[model samples]
Target: MGVSVFSLKGKLALITGGGTGIGLGIAKTMIEAGAKVVITGRRETVLQEAVDTLGKNAHYRVNDITEKETLPAMVEDIENSIGPIDILVNNAGTHHKATAQETSDKDFERILQTNVMSVFALTRECARYMLQRKKGSVIMIGSMAGLFGIDKIVAYGTSKTALTGLVNALVTEYSKSNVRVNAIAPGWITSNMFLNAIANDPQRKQQITNRIAMDHFGQTEDIGHAAVFLSSEAAKYITGVVLPVDGGATVNF
Candidate 1:
């Protein structure tokens, strides 16, 4: 029997902030690809709803990634109770819209703590076990804001840009141990939050549409598929790369 490269048949995936949006998208796709998914979020209700939607292959865990001090024990407990996480998705993040001048120190720090520091802490905890096993994939959810100049998101952009550095640094240190670290930078995707933002400012929507080579916003499934590919054995040889899932927006003039 030829093994399928994309099949995650026996794997277990842990996704932070998996209750909604892109994280929920990833959880759904990962389940379809044959992995048992554990989706975590701060709200039990939200997580349960996601699990219910995902059906039998999905499970829910209540977690607040921002509580950095508890992350080590939390990850350990998840691994021991749920399963050895073969894939870890650092999808929990916060977005703050403000220019450098307008961004308050508190706001910047809050964004950093949620988006960057928490991701690092959780990743490190999961990696310790993966390293011992010499097998695992870690996917960081990066943003287009990190790729190019996006106004009014100074703090959010800075935090995302740091993820690229995190991927590179971790790959250098952990790739030899068979733990791959990579990132996926999503394009402007259609969601309630995005729709509201664009509805309020049509000019902003037009500007975004014009830049995308596809001339349209991407879907959540676009990101979900990318996450699955990266986490599967198909990408075993790939690591330390920042893949722009952005409809050529980063390069388009």
Candidate 2:
């Protein structure tokens, strides 16, 4: 091909939890693909650091997705101040490892509020703007926990599973308006989150790798590339679908 179908020139994308890890990876890739990227997180310092490192095309905002009531105004501010968001990546999510019996109400609510409630709130507000403009892509950062139940992640897994429903519902509702909604279920991505835990135990690492056909830790860039492809014109006809960037972990095991 003369140029990749993944060109995102002139597009504006908003990524949540973009100060680090997979969120930052997505922001970086989108910027390289010629999109103006705005990233938001609870830490201003970290977000700024990401913006500084990501160069002039990247912008940063400080906002906590856990604050459900504040999401509307935050989304509004981005739309008005940063320009219309042609793409929204709901990448902000938190996970707590606990069995259903051991999970407390406070912990359960926290997970639901951060992972499910905020995503819906942000998606709703962004969908409104996209509906008016009649063009947009809302990409959800789903997890393998949702695709297949994982132990000790009762609350987190529940929220991620809910994300799939959100994608399907919105896809049906907004496809008529030319707004496409999709989700990506990433396998274990190599991040500070995973690296620190697996630093010493080669056996644990091997156990993890054996589950995946790829036989390696999937990097943040892998997720970034997947997000770009799904958000770009390359996947114009794709919607209501959950694409796995999991390296066959879900299937191989």
Candidate 3:
């Protein structure tokens, strides 16, 4: 109802896997909206570089979310040493490019551990703190792969599909309180990693673009912009919904 709806001033946002790609982009967008952002990853170097690029308000956490033994302690540490975690972006995930039949048990387990389990662990721990504050947001980065029967990425697709379920259940229980939860399903984004993959093969790129209604892939910033909105008051009424920022890919296809 006011200009402050989309403003994230004075908020603290933590983004996992935020040292690069879509995560980094979202961190930058939130900072621009006046939110203090912490971009985290397993690698110290990458996290540090991301912090540097994101300016002083940007911080880095080197803890691996998949390491269950450390997540609880790390969350507590950040809460006390850093600040109350007002927002959590469970963006850390792993992608496996393999056919359903060809994918190994280990591969499946690894994907689940990173993409799903880690999110569950971090959210559960962080929710305790948010419950006390009665104000926070949790954003799970999902994928368009879950929208349909995508090929050659069974593990990745399944995890994203599960994320929707997570959002729905969590929102139903938390909407009446301080914590709000939601998810974003992004389509083929033109990040450095993705652009290289698309550029390496001509037909694959064209086929993908042709299938999308916009005739193009989305930029990482597009997803970032979406994240900022969801974390801000602009999305106060929005929860438990999976917003697809897929460049009309879902509709056309």
Candidate 4:
């Protein structure tokens, strides 16, 4: 019998900012699904540590996606050395916490460059090869900040909102070629960063917990598992959709 549609046995996936947090989760899950995964970040040590934990099926590359000029060559190098990238996860991002009134032009622009522009640069470079093959999946890691409004994160929210638009536009241009573009908007996922944010702020933590229908935060694996399903052939017919992995937070009142 043929392999399961969900199995990613021979696929090569490249995930940006995969050395830690949500990106790391996605890398681990993709490896478990049988895909040979390549994770990229600026920190060589962190990337190597994650590769070690993810075992042999996982690999690491040190590249800063924010350097737009270098992206095309980097993609070529990865494809030449490892394999054709069947899946590209635009997961590298940064967040800024400040009101719109307090957000300087430079701050907003920096967030946009990292979260939106860099994602486009990498996706385009990878898509060039995928277009020739007439097959690939592109997954954007979005955020709850874009799903709805929360105070003090104007720049971050704006960047994430842009990703939804990016997904739709890419699918329109590439879906006919069998290349799929979609996004996963993760809610409050449990991670050291998140815990640290809420550690001393009891009120903030309580407010977040109350808003979640599940009455708790989600795990990084929640986002990872969703990414795997969307990247696999199981989701061949799905494109331009944003799957929320937010523990019902977006739906809660």
Q: Evaluated with lDDT, which candidate comes out highest?
A: 4
List residue ranges in candidate 4 displaced over 4 A. 1-3
Q: Across residues 195-246, which tens digit of lDDT does each residue of candidate 1 receive?
A: 7657777888889989999867888788999999999878989999899998
Candidate 3 Cα RMSD (Å): 1.4
Q: What lDDT does candidate 3 reach at residue 191?
A: 80
Candidate 2 regions with alpha-carbon error over 4 angstroms: 1-4, 196-204
* Residue pairs of candidate 4 with colliding backbone atoms: none
State each model's CA lDDT, in order. Answer: 0.90, 0.89, 0.87, 0.92
Q: Give the clash total for candidate 1.
A: 0
Q: Could you tell me the lDDT of residue 213 within candidate 4?
A: 92
Ranking by lDDT: 4, 1, 2, 3
lDDT of 2 by residue, 128-233 (tens): 8999999999999999889987777899999999999988888779999999999999898988766865677698678778888886778898999988998888
Encode model 3's per-residue lDDT on 47-105: one tens digit a residue: 88888889989988788888988988888888888888989999988888778999999
Selected candidate, larger TM-score, 2 vs 3: 3
Clashing pairs in 2: none
RMSD of 4: 1.3
Per-residue lDDT of candidate 4, residues 30-148 (tens digit): 98899999999999999999999999999888999899999998999999999999999999998877779999999999999999999999999999999999999999999988899
> CA shift at 79, candidate 1, in angstroms?
1.3
